[model samples]
Target chain A: MNHKEETIRVVNLETGYNSKKGATVITRGINASLYSGELTCLLGPNGAGKSTLLKTLTAFLSPIKGEIFIEQKPLREYSDAELSKVIGVVLTEKLSLNNMSVEELVGMGRSPYTGFWGRMNENDRMIVDESITLVGIENLKGRMIQTLSDGERQKVMIAKALAQETPIIFLDEPTAFLDYPSKVEIMQLLQRLAREKGKTVFLSTHDLELALQIADKVWLLDKPHGVTIGTPEDLALNDDMSRYFYREGVEFDRESGLFKISHKLDQAVRLIGEGARYNMVKKALARQGIDVVDADDCDVEIETTDNCYIMNGKEVPSIEMLLDMLNLYCK
Target chain B: MNRKTTMLLMLLLCLSIMAFLILNLLLGTVKIPVKDVIDILLGNDVDNRIWTNIVMKSRLPQSLTAAMAGAGLAVSGLLMQTVFRNPLAGPSVLGISSGASLGVACVVLLSGSIGGVALSKLGVIGEVTITLSAIIGSLIIMGLIAFVAQKVKGNVTLLIMGVMIGYIANAIIGVLKFFSAEEDIRAYVIWGLGSFSRVSGGQTTVFIVLMLILLPIAFFLIKTLNLLLLGDSYARNLGLSIKRARLLVIGCSGVLVAVVTAYCGPIVFLGLAVPHICRGLFHTSNHATILPASLLGGASLALLCNLIARLPGFEGALPVNSVTALVGAPVVMWVLFNKRKNEI
Candidate 1:
């Protein structure tokens, strides 16, 4: 899946904080390579050292052992100024600039390239305009950053990074506090950016299903596992995806390649239907801790059609009515 | 608006400075005519020696002192607020003024306790001692803050530390005052009251020249200040050296406050409120615009306050500190209310 050239490579890396006693290594011996023109998602549970890894990768924190190479140069070698031109970052902190216009905010990305006075030249202004247009925020160019919604602010940040024109972009939980559609939209935008712009887009996220759907490459990070890198389908096919995320009540459904909550099967119903309607009835029944099966031993039979569910020879207008009929008849 | 309009506004503000400066000279306790004031300024021999002496010796220098002190304090306040990212941050917020006062207290109270020589009687030597002591005190506090800023990560923490240091200095000043004579205490209290006409002749020249030099140097920080407004992480990511930048800004601001407080007796409000007024007027935090705008606005406001303080009815110029507070408090309140209304 990684057909493009590798932009960043991590080898035998150890990342964590340094205490007075000794090094507190969160995760060790991590080997990973991020290629250009790919969207990589670093998926992990809480306290899985995702942020530590991100911080280490961005050179914010020093790695205890091993080395990281950015564009074949040692990450430690590039000066902050040189590295900035190569790798842009978007952090999770809320920006406090209240009176700054979106255009000015994005124009700040030209800092490393601008002169001592930081006055933007024509080329810089054109790049800023292009980045804003790329993020589809041209209408918001004149608006203040404080007036924007969280989603729009995130987009503006992305535009800022885009204006930086770096080969790689690293974001720390960019979709964390956004609404559902906003999360999906941001993920999709990042995915498209990586694919179209040939950037090595790396982000750490808690959104499992969104990442699975959008990421070109997924890095499953766990404390014990260290790092597992591959495409989403490959990780799913090799059964590497299920081992780490496994919990008591959650099961990875291999058929659809998604995680589903494993419900109790104390109550049973034989679901008889096909297509979308049957799936809806099965899902509704599962919510009530009722199991759906094809066996005749079940007491209640739910036969679903295009818009209605028939249970026990009585036609129910909706899933709600079907649940009510099941409660009355099955008991 | 565009850069041209921004420049025009700055020019308009400069014009306001000139207008206020002239008004401050003309409208004082003696009520010198505009013609006499202009003639005196043009180096012409005025008919009345008393009017000439009053206009040249006192009014002109006092007006210049007030304008420079206001501009310096306001610029320093802008730097502190931007660096600390706290709206309420000012030169005094970091206790730099207390540092200066502490220095003055040490000299005044110690002299009174040891030799019975009042602060007003120390002559030229006493004035020089006060200036040197004030500079030393503020520099020591600023140096401590710069050292702590290196060790600490948060600006808020540094701010609190500065406040604590100020409290410590104030506590020492209180103890010194308790042991001193009544005349010494009265002198200290009057100094605390603040005045713009305190400096004249050689001292006034030194104060104005130092501020002129420092103000231009502060302009060199325009780029750094703009970067700083992006906050620490982003500023660092943009190749700014956060520790070094913080130290430079804090050092510049500390020196500005030190110089102004030494000359003007801890004048308030101009430093704390002028930046906010500029921000509200321009509706942008870009230091390129805000810096010059603050400088001009502060000068104009200070000149206006000086004029009001020296109105024909008031005896010995109604205390400047009270006038600044009475006038500046409303502007601050209005800006805060408008900012809240805009939800900025």
Candidate 2:
């Protein structure tokens, strides 16, 4: 642990939508400290106010009460240009850039730092190029943004944020529409960004498995109340997980550290082997529903068979043939 | 192009515009060479009084009107497109032009019927009625569109609503046309055909002043517009007052559209087509470049259309709108058909 103080602090924050009547409070009294160089996943079920909280935290919505601080300064105190230098954002909305090339789109990340006319100088170009290379989309630099795939577009967006060179990055459901592999890749990239580059990444996601596997800390947005923030193991051990996710006959298996249906019964499998092959054989035997027993106590003979099954010095290529041989011997 | 190159191109464009204006003044129904045109401009012309009157009064003001109208419509289109984040959005989409047309229709068709006794009693009131009605109609439609824009979240929906409003306004114009007399109908038809020659030297000053007021507002709102391109939430995240910014942009665009409508009688295509052409030419949507580029491009395109309209062989000048449509429609169509598949 770096033992550094928290970089993002939210104290008693209340947020919601506003209407003619008054404010509609979605959730209240959320308190959390997001630390430096940490990958924090905001986890919650659908309609649990995860997005609202993320929006509030990112200053997209004004909190009716309490305060948010970045680097010990009040979030609202910073000008847009000043704040953009400290925090970068990746929104969920899709952008349309018809004539703009990928590099130009990425270059827009430096907007906050650019002059009044928004001209890009040599240093700005270098940063854009480097960010493009960092996101591993250098090959698509010349291509139009509208030509990129969804996953590729997401990466380019991330590259754009990276080009901003902000210390903290906030993403709103970046993996929402990505396939499983792409989702995993994005999570891994985020982890690498936090660990290697010392950047703090805060993202909202419903992908609990990926969050549990990758995040340094998890903030679960429980319904009708505030959020719970801790390590993934801490939340799991405290049994706070069930409150966020509810499905009939489904439960978290503490021992295996995975989710399983409560109605499912375990079918035991036994195998005899010494090292690497032991687990492989166990898995193969588990698929067949046959138990592998110890050699001394087993009634069945064990041998390495090639091209045919040989038991007690008899060769039988087919199961029927082996059964007939056994009946003949018994008679 | 590089910054220097773009700057140089803009300069060349300005120079060419000046040259075209001079040429338009010199060569018209009666042939006056370039030297006589320059000499007339300098107040030292040894020419026929009729020729001087034509050069000084009609041709000069007409050319200036064409340039100003072109620039105004183009800037309005550019601003509308940026604010709405739609390539297809224009001043016409919001029925501002139709509003002007409706005003003209009422003047030509309903004036005699609505205020026959008043017209006979007060002739000045009749002329004032027409201009005021047109200005009021444009303002009313602008107000409606601005209200709708505040309510609507999606750009595409706003665009569709604008088109519907235009259709409804045109329907009202259709009804007015049914009651109009042939002479009145001819006057309205000629206005509908569009003309820069209608603006006198005095009106040109008003046009320039209105543009001067509106262009700065557009420039001042550039930062907010850039934030807006990222969408509302993102803009809010950046601490931009989105509602305020939207109002400012809408107000600016309304003024631009209204001024052009008041003067040029809803000249077509410049507002709808020039912005896209400028965007394509500049290869960037950043308003810093696009705004000025659209202005120059609009000026050039308008001058070209005006020149084509006044080509010597034609018995009378072709409709300015017809010339612009012939040039502009193809370019806009190409943009629509060949647009990249992944654009929103």
Candidate 3:
């Protein structure tokens, strides 16, 4: 394993857009360090400036205040050509391309390295093949980019970024349009690239559950709080994630590392048993305005065992019947 | 899609351009013998001096003008399509061709009505006035478009702006036609019909020289053009300065359209359809192949159109515009209809 190093260091960064009208700052006083050999995910509500920060760090939008350092040098000092060699990005902008083969599109990633005409030598070709192999989309090299599914397209874009051979990769919602399994696949692929290649991989995503599970570091951006950066485990344990999503009816469950809706316990009943069936039965009861309690109380105690529900010595064959009986008995 | 196949297709396109060029030079109203035409082209003695004169003075310049204008307009179309990332965008999509027509309308229509000058009286001098005015009009629009391209961040916004400008120019021309003398309106209408032979011998050399210089310059942009296929954000992250590339591409396309429309009188359908044809035949949108294919395909199609325009039945010569839309529109419609799912 390669040792982690701070490839990108930010101090008191204020990011936004500058129009002829005036400079409108989006986020203020954001101090963060993005390290190589780790996967960092930025989580925030919509319009919280996650994209603005990413754009500023990648030099798409100039920062309104503070400074950014790439490889211990000032960000402003690096030319656009120099910065392209250092960072690769997969953006959320929908590509409207047609009749272009996958390899040709991926070969375009070599622009920063190739000469003016962008003719790739053998070494560049080998790197492109390796990138496709890494992303496991070798089957798609000959197919047109427009024909590929959304997940396949996302993988192709990632492979394109990988082919650039940069030390840092920034993705804006890389998993936005992917299915659940594909989302997990993309997240794992990014994490593996960061760990194996020692590349600093950073991305902003709305997939909070997936990021909490797979990311090595998480940066939480919200309106009032500028940015809260820590490991996912540390953030969840320190109640940072919970505090970030603090609302009237939503509670961030530290145990599951997920946010759950806090339902009112209007009527409580004793429910017993554990395992998959028990959880399903509990869910069915909870949906019907009945709260499951650990302590024995009131009447109507239901026990689940051997894929069957028993209430007051009456064996219930199915959850539907159990719900029916509970409705009648509770009434 | 492979290199070998692309090379073979490119060679085929070049061969077609040659074959069509020869047919255009060989077949005409005069029906000069193929051997004699070849002899005359080779600078050998020919029995008939008139045949030699017709081939050298008329057909040669006309065919060369059509070929170069076709290639130039096709390349400019490819640039516009890539910059906007819109498949429907063509050389005149920026309203540059309309600007040229407006200039010709002002010079031709206004000349007879206001200055008491008829095209019959002015003759060749009137042609020069019209061409120069077309140049002035289109360059003014090109300059305006290039200026706006730098300030606007959105490609679609620039596209819409160009389209609105074109509409405004056409509206002005409509008003000019309403007030013009009948003879002046007829002259303006003839200019609007478009012809390859309108550019005289000296101007033919100039047009070819200009396109010969400008077309090769587009090759230097193949890399940037390819990156642009990935859309603006990806192109920018690839180290392509999007604004600069936009300005350069819009400038290249605008100048090419301006020159072609000024000389050729807004030749239509060749610029819009040739790139689409190349894409269909090559089955790839990579500019490295599509750009050259469009060039050669355009020249071949234009030569074919010229030959058909001057065929036996047509009196004098059919307008090159009608010939192009007649022969070229179906192939483009078929390519577009088949690829309706992915228009670009």
Candidate 4:
């Protein structure tokens, strides 16, 4: 797995839809390769064709131009049945399921391997149970799908994909409706699946920082710039993140490898701190248009301690008070 | 529920079907004793020749027709609900029943205009023609709807299309009725009222044979229906061809409804409600269980309704359509109320 195996290679792909009127291309001239044992993420602004790209790659939609290859074969060559044996997908569509247990829903993932009756054998049942365990949703096995929370449902769908035993998995906005913590959990789970299972996992998500932090490789699908593919650090170091998301008040913070809202702090203040709390105070001051500087002759000075902030000769217990004290003393 | 419990429920349903079939045979105008009815059914010659003729010709065929038609309608209903993914979908809801009525209406009017005689006078040949015409009529409508279904998405939209088409079919039927002679109109009205008693003698054999062939084929679709319950995209990703599955399910459901309507006159509510009742009873939507449950549950319920229709003191048997709606509506409402917008 560490030898860098390419599972999906797209050459000059153009993705969109066609109707009676004609074909409308969404994104074009995209060349990329997704590797096994790597969690690849596709990130873009809305309508940047992330879903379209996933659809085309998954063979749900025919590409307008260019070719996609799964392993060494062309995508068009694989029949729907063959593709099902190789790839599993979790879509963004809302499930309207009723009266089906979580275990049964996961069991349906073995459809490609089941006979006409779809009655699972012992091995299929074991695989289904293993998938539930793998997704860490053993507790939800007996629960009805209708009763599951959004996060639990998402996990069960992932378990279903796992039960399919496909090498490649594609998910569309898997973290879209989840809370912040659940979003992180789903992302980390996908990363772990890629690492431990050596499966090629590709997903499109709007969780930017989470993807930047956890993805093995990232595809930035900006509107003007086609697609920028690299590791997260490479994109941040090359200033691709900044250029792709070019806008006032938003700048990529290279030190954290995350984006931040940059403030043009014309006024400067001397700050004393050296750790986590210090950076928090610095970011807070920057948001208020005040810059932390090294100059000694400052109208106001805020120094961080274990439990208090010594700001403008007054002891403030919290950052909120420090802001208020600065308002009183400096403004 | 587990398999043993579901099997127990199925066994109970089968027992109920047998009990109701006996009840239907024993309780009638003649009021034959249970012993006598059993003796007659065991192929023994009874002392009362008149009793033998009545049981063999009337009650036996009616009971069998009621049970088979009920099973057919229920299976078709389950299929309609699955393919449309709506709680309210059925042959009746989807206008296929109206198409059957339209087919019969056209046949009745044509026979009336050409022969200058009522449809009742045409006898066995007439019944066969009506059955064939009704099947053709409903199947044609079902084919149209299936074609439209390919173009349309959304449950409510397809339902709305179904309801609209039903209204159009009813309108055409209304025009046909206007041209029909008085006796033809009366015969048409009686057929529309729906009856288990209408199918008797050799006509009963044809209806039963048709259902026997059609209903078993529906079981093969349990896998397809289960996959469809996951919705279109998920089912497709699992290697199902949605268009083919939809067409097959609708066609199967359509033929079942067509035959039942041709034989029983658009038996209402059994097709739509039996699946819901089965889902409620089994507490699962897996079609492997629900289809069989629907089959047996449908037979029991229809027999119960048939028994109720011909109960003591009434002048004649009640229209099965009226009894089915009366009994089925509440069962549906109760299930819906308990389940609260949950679908089959």
True contacts kept of each: 0.52, 0.25, 0.72, 0.49
| lDDT of candidates 1 onward, in order | 0.89, 0.76, 0.89, 0.89
Better of 1 and 3 by DockQ: 3
> In model 2, which residue pairs have backbone atoms overlapping below 3 Å?
none
In Å, residue A145's CA in model 4 sits off its true spot by 0.3
**Residue lDDT tens for model 1, B201-308:** 889999999999999888988888988988888887787888999999999999999998888888888888899888888888898899999999989889888889
Q: What is the TM-score of chain A alone in each candidate?
A: 0.97, 0.80, 0.96, 0.96
Give per-model TM-scores.
0.97, 0.82, 0.95, 0.96
Candidate 2's residue-wise lDDT over B1-344, tens digit each?
Answer: 46787787778778878877876787677887777777888899555788778888888888887887888888888878877888777888778888878876877677655654323234445444555666778888888888988898776787788789889999998887787666666667776788887666666676667767766667776666666776666565444566677777877887788777777777888888998887776666667777887888888889889988998976488889899999989988988887867552
Better of 1 and 2 by TM-score: 1
Q: How accurate is candidate 4 locally (lDDT)?
A: 0.89
Candidate 2 global lDDT? 0.76
Deviation in Å, model 4, residue B240 alpha carbon: 0.9
Q: Per-residue alpha-carbon lDDT of model 4 for B65-94, expressed as tens digits?
A: 999989998999999988888887877999
- Residue range A146-213, candidate 4, lDDT tens digits: 88888999999999999999999999999989999999999999998999998999999988899999
User: Lowest-scoring 10 consecutive residues by lDDT in candidate 2 chain A?
Assistant: A264-273
lDDT of 3 by residue, B1-344 (tens): 77899899989988988998898889887778899999999999999999999999899999999999999889998899888988779877789999899888888888878888886458667777887899899988888888888888898999999999999999999999999898888888888898999888677888889889988988989998998888888888888988888888888888888888888888888888898889888999888788889989888888889989988668588999999889767866776678755556
